[model samples]
Target: MGTAILSGIISSQGSGSGTQEIDLLPTRFIACVRRPESEDAIRSKLPREAPDSTVSVYVKDNCAAAREADVILLACQPHLYKPLLLESGICTALKGKPIISVLAGVTSNEITHQLCQTAKTESKGVYDTDAFSVIRAMPNIASAVQASSTVLEIHPRPQLKGVIATAHAIFSCVGTVFTTKPGNFAACTTLNGSTPAFFAMVIDGLVDGAVALGLSHTEATQMAAATMRGTADLIMSGKSTLDLRYEVACPGGATIQGLQVLEEARTRAVWMRAMAAATSGQSSLKEGLKMSRGGF
Candidate 1:
């Protein structure tokens, strides 16, 4: 997560023309933690010239890192989140700090519950579990290149108002940000996290068809990619998808022929079904999270 988000920030600020600097992103220092064995590999993945003055890595010392940082990102795998939160004392260390989770399917309530459990066991006054400030976020892998679409959800609280700005600022460095209610988080995950992979497949399929028509694979892929980008830009510029399709597909042109093929294959239905499947699967994932609370 550090590599992904940090790479995007570095790209947006370092190379993206006309991109504005994210003021909420820390410029002074960053504390990153990873497994001891992964320290070198993770460090190698970091940007050579990150905007932050220092990025200190703590191996297998999540609590130390949490204690040192004002904002803590729990970006571990979904399965590992429970263990990391419960076993590491990191939740206790988080205390009143902002904890943003990028773990898929793990809700903010689950995080708060685990923190309260940890506090009860530890008998520590370090954490105020009843008023945990947790945020759930879904940002795509495209963040590595400063093109992700991120969705965030924070349980409404007065304390979280300012936290949203910080969250928005941090994510905006990578790409556009959208705020969603907790009820819509799973749907947002399918949109932001899964849609990019699905669109990549669409792009590749277009490239394959182009190659079949005698275009070089590289040439076809570049054209298809550029077309997708331009189409999105057009849509954002106030042209509806249907209007754009109508504009491109003349009465009996090649574009209309291609669209007819897609229509015959029920392409729109297929996409809708895919999204429905992902959204439906969230319930099972939530159940699994509950059953696997003790460990990964």
Candidate 2:
């Protein structure tokens, strides 16, 4: 999912700017590593607008890619982060480069510590862990459409300023970016990372409601989605939900009547509970990762 979204952004940018876009980044080659059999499938899914030269796919050969790229994005499954960081030659290749992990259930500290351990083991006395950085980001599947609400977490290491700026630039191309502190990272994940799925559930409910009112499924779904998009746009444009509600309610109107039903059902409280559970689940996930990594 991350690969497809990133490829879409890179590819679309490539087409829009052509060779001129090469100036946007210091390095132009993007290595997308995957399992041997998955290489072809992943490549086939790349956007047609993507130029062949911008991204190269490698099969089971991540070290080579890391060595060639200045900045690396680790979008692999969360469970694979430690092993991959400790892979022979991978730490050496990744030494001094910025690594951005989109892997859930894994913390930046975990990834950074593993990398530091690998570097110390490989280079012995010459290792400088401060030279490298690890950043954790949570971007939803909406990134595929360049409209994700992404949240990023990073330590206040002075050395990582450039890396953070680079990350901001890359993600800004895809969607809005929010920098989150460590304490709030989990909460941000529940809101920014997981809320899209929650919104989808609401959309489904709205669509079902319309269908029950005699609208065809196709028309109902479209209208629900459009309404959602427009409502979000209006909210984004500085219109408060309260103001919008009053605007549509018109005192004793159907909108207000329907809102009363929603209020009676405690829909807002239900969503609040859902997000609270999800945020707690993220803490559990972090604990599980710590246990798996022997309390790293």
Candidate 3:
């Protein structure tokens, strides 16, 4: 997910005049990771046009990277947050920065608490608990293709104004950005994070059906994908799902006949269940750290 967002940002349109918001787009990206080999691994996967000067990789040095960045995006695993924050000079480097986190189920308040914890733990007693303005975001895998549905938790505090704009500016590179209350973010994560996999499953099933009807796999795959894209576009353009479905499933048409099969199978109900299950899973995830506790 972190790599995908990087790819999208690297693919961003070049610098623009003050008239366009592109001027606010990131000019540099610094990714900090624990392993030395991971640096090359990340660089290898990015867009070919991404220059070494534009993107820097920090090997086990979060403070150095955070110090150089204007806005800090926390993309590391949730469990790693504790150790990452505990790094020497971490809080000091993050001071006054707009911190955006992509950690699923983790709240900005929780992140603030972690930063405060680190401030107290630093060997040098110069502590800075008010280190950042937090923006919690969830950007999906489609960010690699610049079509992600990103969910950003919106806070209306005056102190967070700059970070709010920064969040929009940064996330807009990937795709649409949706703002929701902190309370709604967990539910919204289903749409931003889980639905892509669900939609892919639907596409897979559709393609298989087409293949079963004797269409070549390649042909079926392309057709299904294109159709899905067009349908999504229609919906985005304000066509209601029921209206769109009805338009295609004309009276006594083959579309309606096929719909009957799916309708009888309770496909819609299954999808609702899937959504509930995903939301439930996210709630559990946000409840607390559950991943590996191993340090960086």
Candidate 4:
């Protein structure tokens, strides 16, 4: 995700000024990794062949490197995040800096408390202000190629303003950015994080249908993919998806015949059920965690 964000920021130079101007300059990126092996792997992946921009990579344990950063990203998995940040002493180092978290199922208030405890332990003094500002964001895999649909929630410190511009510039390079309430992050995760999988399944089903009609697997897949892409483009170009579907369903035509088959099978209801099941499972996990915590 960090690599994706970096790529988007660097590529935004060609995307014109309005939102792109806020992304970090290529030279400003300071990537830090916790493991030595991961550092070597990342360095190997750098575009040494023909590069327009460069990134400075640092290999160190988290907190130590975090001290020098004005904006720190916490990108580890949720279960490991609190313990790792607390143990690394990064929170103590964040004095008045911003800490952006991409960990799923972890709330800003929880992060604030953990950081406050860490800071208190390190300083042994009562601090009157929040030591760090946190922003929780949910960005999908498309970010790797600068085509993500990112959802962000700002939980700014009392003294901070104008941070949204910075975030917008950074995320806009990859795709669209939508401001959402912190409580909605989990729903955003289900909607955005799980969408690609849902789309892929639809594509696969289309390909299967094509293959059943005697097309080769490769041919079917290509045809299905192109059809799906074109449909998406049409929807994005101002036509509602339902409107497009209705347009294709000519009265008693081949398209309508196929639609009848799908309707009889309750295809739409099946997909709705699938999404509800996935969302319910995730919500249940959240509730279980809260119970374990004796209340979140």
TM for every model, in the order presented, reads 0.88, 0.88, 0.91, 0.82
What are the runs in model 2 whose C-alpha is more than 4 Å off? 14-34, 124-128, 284-296
Model 4 lDDT, residue 114, Cα: 75
What would the per-residue lDDT of candidate 2 be over residues 110-211, giving only the tens digit for each residue?
A: 787788788778877445667568887877777666787888886688987777776776676667788988778878878887788899899899888888
RMSD of each: 3.9, 4.1, 3.3, 4.9
Report lDDT (Cα) of residue 230, candidate 3.
94
Q: List the residue pairs that clash in candidate 3.
A: none
Candidate 3 structure quality by residue, lDDT tens digits, 126-195? 4444456887998898888788889889887888878888888888887888899999887887878889
Angstrom error at residue 134, model 1: 0.4
Cα lDDT of all candidates, in order?
A: 0.75, 0.73, 0.81, 0.67
Off by over 4 Å in 4: 11-18, 23-26, 44-53, 127-129, 154-160, 280-296
What is the Å distance of residue 141 in model 4 from its true position?
Answer: 0.6
The reply for model 3, stretches above 4 Å from the true place, is 14-19, 123-130, 284-296
Task: Write down the lDDT that model 4 would get.
Answer: 0.67
Name the lDDT value of residue 284 in candidate 1. Answer: 59
Clashes of each: 0, 0, 0, 0
How far residue 249's Cα lies from its native spot in candidate 2, in Å, is 1.5
